[model samples]
Target: MNILFIEDDMIESMKFQRTLSKIASRHTIIEAKNGEQAIDALKNSESLPDIILLDLNMPRMSGIEFLQILKADEQYKYIPTIILTTSENRADLLECYRIGIAGYVIKPLKYEDYEQKLTAVLAYWQTNELVKA
Candidate 1:
């Protein structure tokens, strides 16, 4: 799987990356610091990511803003996006769902828990694909 992660916090991003690596060693993970960089990464990529993990509070462009832009574009509209943020507020969660995000995951500080979340997300994708088939 090709995963695009848009997170502004460098340390947090690296930690998630490490957890993901352990969970799915063969998966290709790409990092983008903010929404603007995420858009650029999408634009420059030869292939679209299977899933995008976005953080709500980011510099340049916020995750909600990115979700709007991506959902508006036909080429990217179908790509699954999951909100991965430290925010657990109801408003943020509702807003992300309103913008058509596939899932909303709260950022876990523990590496083991993060891995579990990643595994669950991957499983959800697989289950969805099976249903579609």
Candidate 2:
């Protein structure tokens, strides 16, 4: 599966890549540092990603802002976006669901925990049938 990973922190981005490398090699990851970059990727790519793993906090545009634009557009609304953020705020959680996210995963503190969560998330998405244009 092709994944669009949207995150601004370089260390966190590297950690996610490392986790993916350890858990699965069949999947492909496309990195975007912020919502603006993510939007550009969506607009310019020939093929859209199978899923989007987004971080709530980012520069240029917040994840909610990005979701608003994405969900509003007929061309992009079908893509399943999963929030992979550290925020545990109820308001944020409710907002993401309200905006129509496929999943919401709060990043755990430990690397092992993070890896486990990512592994399950990836496995589920990989095996599950998804919407295709």
Candidate 3:
């Protein structure tokens, strides 16, 4: 599977990469520093990602803004987007659901907990059939 991981924090991004490498070695991950960069990656990529792991807080554009733009577009709307954020805000959760996110996962403070959550998420998605286009 291919995943587009959008995050602004370098340390968090590195941590995620390390954890993901341990869990889903077969999956390919593409990194984007912000929502704008994520959009550019989508536009320029030869193939769209199977899923997107998005962070809510980013420098240029927030995750909600990115989702709004993505879900509005016909070509990208069907791709599964999951919120992998540190925020547990009710409003953020509600808005992400309203915008059509596949799942909302809070980034756990502990490395082990974070890895477990990511493992579960990946396992679930790996079993589901995704739109090839």
Cα-based RMSD of the predictions, in order? 2.1, 1.3, 1.4
Per-residue C-alpha lDDT of model 2 across residues 16-75, encoded as one tens digit per residue:
988988974577788999999999999989898999999999988999999999999998
The residue pairs in collision within model 1 are none
> Model 1, 1-133: lDDT tens per residue?
7888889998887787677667634667789998889899999999888888889999889899999999999999888998888898999899889889989999787877887887888778755773233
TM-score per candidate: 0.90, 0.96, 0.95
- Flag regions of model 1 displaced more than 4 Å: 130-133
Residue-by-residue lDDT tens digits, candidate 3, 48-93: 9999999999988999999999999999999999999989899999
TM-score winner, 1 or 2? 2
Task: Give the best candidate by lDDT.
Answer: 3
Give the distance in Å from residue 62's predicted Cα in candidate 3 to where it truly belongs.
0.4
Quality of model 2 by C-alpha lDDT: 0.91
TM-score sort, best first: 2, 3, 1
For TM-score, the strongest prediction is 2
Candidate 1: lDDT over CA atoms? 0.85
Better of 1 and 3 by lDDT: 3
Q: Which ten contiguous residues of candidate 2 have the minimum total lDDT?
A: 124-133
